[model samples]
Target: MKDIIILMFRLMVCIFEIWMLFGFYNNFLKNKPRKSRNNIFIILVFALIIFAINSIDNTILNLICVPVVYFVLAIVAFNGNVFKKLFGTLIGTIVILGTELIIVAVLNITSKELIESSMVNEPSAFVLTIIVKMVTFIVFEIIKQFSSKESEMMDGKTFCLYILTPLSCLGIMFSVVFCRIDFTENSLAKSVLIIFFFCMLIGNAAIFYGYNRYAKILVEKEKNRRTVMEQKMELESYKKVNVANDRYITLLHDTNHHIKTVYSLLKKDKKDDAMNMLSKLFDKYEKAEMIEYSGNTILNTILSDYKEKSSKENIECDIFVERGFNIEYVDEIDLVAMLSNLLSNSYEAAAKSDMKKIRIQMFMQNDGSFSVIKIENSYTSMIVEEDSVLKTTKQNKEFHGLGIKSVQQIAEKYNGWLSSTWSDNVFKSVLILENSMC
Candidate 1:
């Protein structure tokens, strides 16, 4: 009966540890509930393994086994980057183990014999286990309150910096707990030392929580900066379109003078020159004229502006648009801003490439459920990518990199998405927007 009771207590501790691990994960990683049965089963199998490992009472084996098992659990059952999941597991392990160590250290300070006997007594061990687990639970709750649900990528330096505090604190904890120092004779000093260790444990959690808050503030500031820049670009685009409109109106007012010059050349018996003059007039007219690229006026204006810029840069531009297709669901300013960013990037890329060509294709899908905008530009330079997204190769990276991100944000606003790929000296970007027309 005593053996059964001990086994039950062990099982209870195992279950509690698992619960605490899950709570730690919830602060950072998400469970893969889509495959609920598989996840639960995998966790159960690992729990049993952990329970068996704990029963062996081998310190070295348990240390090696727990982290390995949790790493596996993270990979199979958690939804996050592998590194983040592992980090979460490591933090959980440290908190639980550190709490146990400090509690034991404190118990030893009060009575060394009590600490030693707790190892052999099931009830004493049970009480100690409950104390450690309860403290761990409180620490986990404190962390969860400050944990950001949004998964932000941490750079290597920042990750190292944030993790250093907890690691150093854990080391200090180990040294304080395991060092050859007897505090049994000094009650006041022991009490103070015990309070200090507890504070250190909580302080480790506070460091990560502070990191989360700091990261969130940086993210929000970046978002605000991008918003401001995009709005400024939108206003600039609108101004340029207005300038183009005014220029076209001036060209229209000069039509009579152009016609008379061509007629005068013909009358002067210079047939070839007259033909050349007429050709120049037609070219000028075509340059200023806005081709009906799509049923959307904002799209047409943006395309016309970029097309003119492409001509000035000596970049070949080919644009094909299906007539009568429109995206009225998107706001005018957003549509203009998105297309401007995409075309601007394409123009810059094509201008620097060997081929110097840009092609744009816009059409409604067969099912009339979506509209597609595809931009392809040739490039000879190297493409820098991070996390599968293109990084800007321009010197002014601060402003340049936000172009693709802004395009993506605007696309997503209208139930749309953007994808880009580069190969064979050509880079292609495709934007898909749900068609409200149907």
Candidate 2:
């Protein structure tokens, strides 16, 4: 019974170690469910099962027990596909066993006599074995977290600390297992002091290495982030310039028509004709003035520019915009990109159809939380695809399905939802996004 209890305790330790390792991998190394309560329940259940089965004494049974523990851990960690879970767990088990062997070999070569002497007492030997198991677990976990394919920038300082601190603890354990120390005179005291000193050395070395590696990565990430910010700013400026230039060029071209109309009216020598011409000219000027929605200047410019293009293409564009809000929400450039891409795609599609017409509707929610956008356009050909992605026609090589992808990406970045459908020769795109201010 006593042996059984001891075995249960050891099994409990192994199960707990597995939970910690798997939890770390699931939480930090890969994307997983975020609810804390669900995670706790999963860990607890896995720990219980592994603890129950890991108590077997036979060598073959013990070997079988390892895979069982790993299998349970994989189930908890994966929570979905069995194949993926099995593959990951198998890989993890191999790595852990390999590391344990390496550490054991190093300890045997460096402190063979010390280890043998330490095992004289059953309690001391159990403690030493537990420590060895823990160190092996830590080393393997550290390797797994750091070596994954995920971008390091996404792993914050807390995760980095989790990996580094455990690795340092394992390194200290390695030194403790190997270092020679005279413990006969003051056994407990000498052992404590030696372990403390070994920890200090290992801790320092781990910190030094971790800092060197992570610091460089951090610096490079900062530089890359800065570069991205600069490029976004430049692109915004360029977009604004292009919109302004287009507006200016349209105004200049209209001036010639205005002059010719005025000259022709004056030559007719009728006061009423000149007054009518002047009234029409003022109406044209009023129509040229851009429409503003939600205080987003970029979007206003894009709407105005696209309206003019639609008129020129003989495409009937019907726009319905909600009242402008006082609050500053979504970045103007992003808004422009989103709207322009959607409208431009619609326009292009409409141009190919016999019935060239586009409908645009936009409105802000009463709660000031989100904005909704819907656009529909007439199209010539069927837009259905097996993959749910709309592909470009063969005739249009320069511009393809990239516009839709851009819209989708921008929506995703803002935690937005986008959907599209096509039927009865009409293509529709819809998007809903949280207001940036909220």
Candidate 3:
């Protein structure tokens, strides 16, 4: 009965720990549930069975089993590739086990006799273990939240002090409850080593802070570079649009002369010649410019640019945009960036595929509060993603995928959704955004 009780306590601990880990994950990564989950009930039953077996008290067996349990749960609970699920679960389990070891070290050094007595008394051990688990969980939660949101501008020296403070408190408790070390023999030496460890803890903090600062700087620089490149592309597109519209204006300016020539031919009793001349002029005018417009300048410009591009690439681009469609509240820069990216991706993929076709549809919501853009294109290349992170085929992995990522960020900023699907050798993506991203 006592063994059974211990096992039950351990099982409870496992459940709490799993729940807490996932809670932190959800908060940090903003994970959401998958739609159309038919196997959810089966997954829960498997989870129940995983947490059910704590009776096999062998360390080797338990170590092997814990990883398998979490790995399986990761597959059911997480949305990503198998490699991502297994890797995340494996690292998380190590962190948790490392924390447990830290707590054990503290307990053994501080309340050596109490822990020793607890080893013999199962109830006391269970209680002490529960207490330690809670403490460790809380500490980890604080660390994760802090690290994720830490400011790059934080002073390294002061920040390191802030982090190690809790660690120092934990160490101090161990020192005050000192029992394992022989006090008379080398108490002074042991005290110095404890101080040294505390100092080195700051070194650990420094490494984290330095890496964070470097990564933040690197990301900001990369984004700035991509933004410049995108803006330059936009400028070139606007130039082409301006040139096309100018040519159409020139054709209209010369229309009267062309019409007068046809009229003179008709007056000379050459009606067939006049009609043939008029038809030739009309052909030139149509060849010079063929256009479809949405009232929104940004949307119209990008669609026109891509339409011409599709023709050149021998890809049929079908665009169905609501007539007189206008966007008043969406940021012009953001709109341009998003549309440019979506169209560029479609054009690139469609140009490479055998089908050589791209389809785009955009419409305003009837309620006038939102809009949706849907794009589908042919894709022949395989996509490999890990943990929802897109892998690029380009030489510079850092530079590629910035377009889609920027669009995603824009969507998220507006509390909107960006969804993508690949089926039947076609890739379809949709962006739904609210008006006035205030």
Candidate 4:
């Protein structure tokens, strides 16, 4: 009966651990967390296998089977490249093994004392495991609910902490197990194990505290930057509106002056000169005083600023945008930086080109699902391509291409990407941002 209770307790712990391990990933992904309908079925099936293993357990066999449970849970729950899933399982297994070592070592010390006092039984050990697993489940639930889910997966090296910390715990366990040559005397070995456990706890606490604090600081900085950019965009938007109003008041006078000049040239029968004057007027007067670009005032502000800048630099910028599009969900700073870099590059290239023109195309489509921007420009000098990348002509190659890289990073934040190509002496960049409508 005691053995049966032990198996049931093991089954319960295994089920709880499975839930804790697999459910952890959902907290870190960008999408809303979802529980698979088949998750319960999978857990129950594995719990039976765990119970069977516990009933006829050999230490070696149990060690092997335990990791199988975690691996299965990871494979079922994780959505990623094979390496991510495999390494994720490896981290989970290392933590579990390290934790089990501490549990077993503590259990041995306590069980020996209880045995001496005639209070020890198989059921007592099972009860101890139940208490431990229950406490662990609570901890996992608290961490999952309270801790901030990662905005994105940690870089491979940072995630290695999940491996290194547990491996350190395992190393300490091995030192305690092998060096003393004594297993049971309530000796210095137990003290060492207890200290190692506390040390790991402190280490984990420090990591969590430091990492979360740093992440919070970064997020705050990003928000502040965006807030500043939003204000700047608003100010620019107001300036454009005011300047456009002024231009509206002067447009009639300017048209009257052009018409008088052209009419005089025609009266003199200088038809060619009249036509040249008319063409110049056409070039300068094409844009209306007030043109609606997009509903996103921030975007409109950027487009207007750069359009004026390009005109001043004698670069022709052709902009196209869809009506009634929404980009309120995007971070203003990121959007600004992306467009700023793109236009900066286009201006530089067009300044050096014979054509001296930049073609800009922006549109919203896919039922409010995406906003796309395409910029194409001509480069007169050799593109300086190496390894399929358009190398910068600036002497400081180190900093030359960072603008594009930064723009790419911004695009990635929106679940989109930036791609650039240089072909037939024409350089083009395409940025796609996923729109968040719902």
Q: lDDT of all the models against the reference?
A: 0.75, 0.65, 0.67, 0.65
Predicted candidate 2 versus true structure: per-residue lDDT over 1-438, tens digit per residue: 658745665655665556545744553334356686776676767666666665444667756777777776666456556776677667666766665577567666766686666433444444455555666555554664566444342255655775666566656655654564335566566446544544543454455347547856876775465445435744764676576767667877887887787788788776688788788777766665676644656666667777778888999999877785422566655666677668878898898898999998887785768888989999997664756767776577444555666677678778887899888899889988877776
Give the per-residue lDDT digits (tens) of candidate 4, residues 1-438.
646645555675666666556555445433224665666777677767766776685889988887777666666655556565666566666655665676667757744554443213443343344334433443443445444454433445665655465455545543433343332555345435444454564455455446646866876776565556545644655677677666666777798888998999999999999999988777665563344587775577667777877788888888888665567788766666788778888888888998888888887767778888899998888766676656777999754675776677678889888888887778899998998764
What does the lDDT read for residue 353 in candidate 3? 93
Scored by TM-score, the top model is 1
- How far off is model 2, as Cα RMSD? 14.0
Off by over 4 Å in 3: 1-142, 145-195, 270-276, 288-290
Candidate 3 vs candidate 4: the TM-score winner is: 3
Ranked by lDDT, top first: 1, 3, 2, 4
Model 1 Cα lDDT, one tens digit per residue, 1-438: 768866765675676577557656856787777765665566567778889999899999989898888777777777889889878878888887888898777767865656454232444454455556556655665566457453454555776676666566555644544453445556456546545554665565566657767877988998888778768766877787787688788888988888898789888888899889788878887877887777766777888888888999899999988875667888776777788788988898899888999999988886778989999999888999988878887799876788888888888877899999989999999999988767
Q: After superposition, how far is residue 108 of candidate 3 from its true place, in Å?
A: 10
Per-residue error for 314 in candidate 3, Å, reads 3.1
- Model with the higher TM-score, candidate 1 or 3: 1
lDDT of 1: 0.75
Worst lDDT 10-window in candidate 3: 118-127
